[model samples]
Target chain A: MIRRKILFIGLLGSLFQIFLGCVPLTKTILSPGSPEDLTTCTNVFPVGPWESVHKIEAVITGGVSFSLLGVTRGDPNKRRLHSFLLTPEGFILFEGLLGEDGMTIQKAVSPFDSPAFAGGLMEDVKGLFLPPPGKPARWGRTADGTRVCLWEGPDGFETEFWEAKDQDRQILLRDDLGEVIKEVSLKGPFVNGLASYIELRASKPLPYKLKMTLLQISP
Target chain B: MEKTRMKRFLFFSIPIIISLLSAEAGSDQEWASLKEAAKNIRSVKSEFLQKRILPILTKPLRSEGRVFFQTPGSLRWEYLNPLRSVMLQKGDTIRLYHFSEGEWKPEMTQAVEVRRMVIAEISRWFQGRFDESKIFKNLYVPGPPVRILLTPKEGVDKFIRRIEIFPGTRPGVIERVEIEEPGGSRTSIEFRKTEINPNLPSEIFEKP
Candidate 1:
């Protein structure tokens, strides 16, 4: 009987590992391209501490939908207005503000009350707007000719910002093992200094996504 | 002693119960008549002014829009003021569009269930099924325009404080809706130039 229990336990452990293996975040050798390429790739992006209030409408594919008239003010850390309405009819889904203190969920409906989902959103927002956390680990180009700058964050987590010719910028946050955790892409032109559209995709936890559109920006 | 306590409970409860029954008798009749009248409306088209009050703001933000609703689940909510945004619900799916840069782009609106539920409730109002709705408990208020106060009956009650809907001179036509939020502030949508059962194009429900 004990032997059978051991076998079942081992099977469960292996299945869990396989589940974790499915998230795709691959790393490659730093592409040492021309000096001009590195400057162009990293220069187009904005450096923090930027503050703006954008009328954002975001939807989570099969999960959630809401429109936000929010004020996003932040500098060294991210400050976000956690408010949204389940649209068409204007049903309020959540109303709160989030900062370094984690998510202060003043109002949230069921399923959205989870802290991790909000935390993941803040992480994505920071990744898209604010410059990467630390100094660039390597400033180079990708094999596909996309200019890429990799910033080594704490705890083996790295953020990569890449901008291609005539294309909007893209950001990748990866774990130490080089597995991609979050993929964020900016669409539309940088009006003044902010992009009008942003899409975030997370591989782990669950297949989650948020598409954000900018309405207005201010000082 | 037990018998005396039982007698005391019945004596106090009877008057309270009687008053409650009398209130329901009057209220239920009003609701039943309103629902019966609403049953005749097939569609509605109206222009609305929507104002939202957020805590972060010093003043109420203003927006202007038009709303279209059809019975059995179809709607079009278009905002054309400070910015252009369109929301449409057909069957069980919801589609959103926003004008950005120079053209209209499709927005991801996959939260179909919530939107569906809300649309269902709104559509039922036009269909004259107010008393049959699972979302709210309706109370009739005496007014020159006639008013129905709705308090959400379920989890949605957490987000909504109360909804006061005023019907037009024509039976079953809703002219105004004032939705009170949890924070004491409310959003008032006033419908003007309301038309019912007009010849509407099938194309109006299409994605932008």
Candidate 2:
């Protein structure tokens, strides 16, 4: 009985260590590179203040889809953003401002007047337009020759940016469990390295996808 | 005590309700004339400017479009600038298209009902029976100003506060429509260069 108890405790100890181990993304294994490589990847995010208009096609969970006109103005350097979505006939569905004090929603119509909806929208916006939080712990190339900059948040979540040889880019966010919670693909005729088309797919408490095509952009 | 409160409320409210009814009844003559003018309209084609005002916008967002309407429920409404989209209706069938990548693509099926409602309202306006909306109480306001006010019924008021329609000097022509939301946001559409009974191609109503 004493030997059996020792074996059982040893098994539990090993399980605990495995649970606390660094979780690596199974698909992409990144090797160490340099700070210059990280800077090149960061340029994908816009710097300073800019305003943009986009035609957004959204497919919500259960396959319902709709189109909206999205107008956003943000100074990513200051972490301030104002955005609104309008129907084609000019009905405002949602309008919100994100400042130092966090998000404040000015107006939200039915189906959008929820706190969860507002938070999700802000998360997607920040994910696309702002660089990931914290310095990248790993800046390197993936096994497939894709340039990558990987940041690990204090909470153990991971953000990975990958730039393919064709100049297309992707941003993937993984939970502490190592499951991809969100993935964003950036492609199109880029101006100054800013992509004109963006596709964001979020899989979490609920799944939704937004396909945004740039209509206009200004400084 | 509650009974007395109810009694006092009715005592004050009954007279106000009567006066309001009388005021609407007085406008029946103007309503009949507007309807008469509408009967003369065979078709209408107009360029329109739409302005959306919201507290978030520094200025109203402006868009331009054109509308084509024919008798017996055939219509085409096309936005020409900022975003290019078209809504077409013929008989009971409705179609919506969006311009993307230099080509017109059909919009999703889920959003068809919402677009259908807009087309339906435009149809009612062209028929000069816009006041007959089931969701709103049409209170005709006879004016040197001349406009129709549509106030939403109980449940509908949660979405729409009111809608005001201004009739043009020409018979059966609508000068503008202003939609007010429960919030301070408003949308105004002003019609310009209106052409009445112009020869419009059938394809305009059939295709986007």
Candidate 3:
């Protein structure tokens, strides 16, 4: 009976590890480029604080699409963000403040009041406004000549930022198993280093997509 | 000496009581007159400017729009600038639309639910029945511009703190509305160039 219990516990642990994708898989590496290449890649992120309004179209996994007015005030230096969403008729759906410690939600209506939804939205705000966690682990040009800057997190996750010749940018976040979990694309006519259009897609937690169009950027 | 003091106290208190009673009576009289005026209004059209004030923002977000209403339950509320969207209601059927890529598209999502609630509230205002809300208790204040204050009851107080409505000099016209939220955020909408008893086309309330 003791042996059977031990076997059962070990099987459960292994399954949990696999579900978490804890085993780090090898990712592709490019040529080690110069310092100027790193600067060019890092410049894609905004440096100063900014307030902007966006018209957002969100599509959930099951073909549920809705529109919202998004207002955000982000300070990259402080790594703090205040964001809220409003319905067309001006009812506030969600309002949250994200700081270094965690997220504090002031208001959240149904379908948006879940903790998972709040965490996912905070992750997206960080990805879009702030730079990666630390210094770049690798900076170079891909085979197609796209500028790439890769940052590796302590959790065995990797974030790669790409800038094309036309100034279009793409960010890919990979989990420990080297599978892309979140993808973000930015197209410019940038205002103060902020993209005029942004699209983000995530597969983890749930499959969702958000397309944001710039409406107003504060001076 | 005690009798003299009592007489003096009554002399001051009686006028104060009488004035308070008259003020209350005057408020009720104004309310009844406003309701009587609403019966003559067949339609109403107006331009509106909305300002949303929040502690998180340095400046209030502004939006401009238009509102149209006809008797027997038809309303068209359209936001023209800063985000183009419209809500049309004719009787029980309500439709929502958003303008994208130079065209209006039907919005069949959860957002329509929020708009429907707003339309229901506006419909009550158009009917001069602002004091008839089951969720709020109405208090009439007779200002230079008479104001109607609605305070949310127990269950609904979590979302809304209060609502203030200012009626126009003309009957059945709402000049302004301010909705205050529990979290120190407020939305103020002011109406302008109001036209009362206009002939509204039936097609204006149709679906997008």
Best by DockQ: 3
- After superposition, the stretches of candidate 2 with alpha carbons farther than 4 Å from their true spots are A1-52, A58-66, A73-83, A93-122, A139-148, A154-157, A162-196, A199-210, A216-219, B1-26, B100-106, B109-111, B142-144
RMSD of 1: 13.9
With a 3 Å backbone cut-off (N, CA, C), the pairs that clash in candidate 1 are A25-A180
Docking class of 2: incorrect
Which tens-of-lDDT digit does each residue in B86-137 have in candidate 2? 8999888889987765677777642345557667767888989866655456
Best to worst by DockQ, what's the order? 3, 2, 1
C-alpha positional error of residue B166 in candidate 1 after TM-score superposition, expressed in Å? 3.1
Candidate 1: count of backbone clashes, pairs at least 3 residues apart or interchain: 1
Return the TM-score for candidate 1, rounded to 2 decimals. Answer: 0.58
Write the residue-wise lDDT of candidate 3 on B1-208 in tens digits.
5333222222111111112233332367777888788877889999999988766777788889999999888999999877788889999988888876566778765435555656766877888877776545566668655777766544444456667778887777889987776556778899999999889889999955
The residue ranges of model 3 lying beyond 4 angstroms of the native Cα positions read A1-31, A143-145, B1-26, B97-114, B155-158
Q: Scored by CA lDDT, what does every candidate get?
A: 0.61, 0.75, 0.75
Better of 2 and 3 by DockQ: 3
- For candidate 3, the C-alpha RMSD (Å) to the true structure equals 13.7
Residue A39 lDDT, candidate 1, scale 0-100: 59
Top-TM-score candidate index: 3
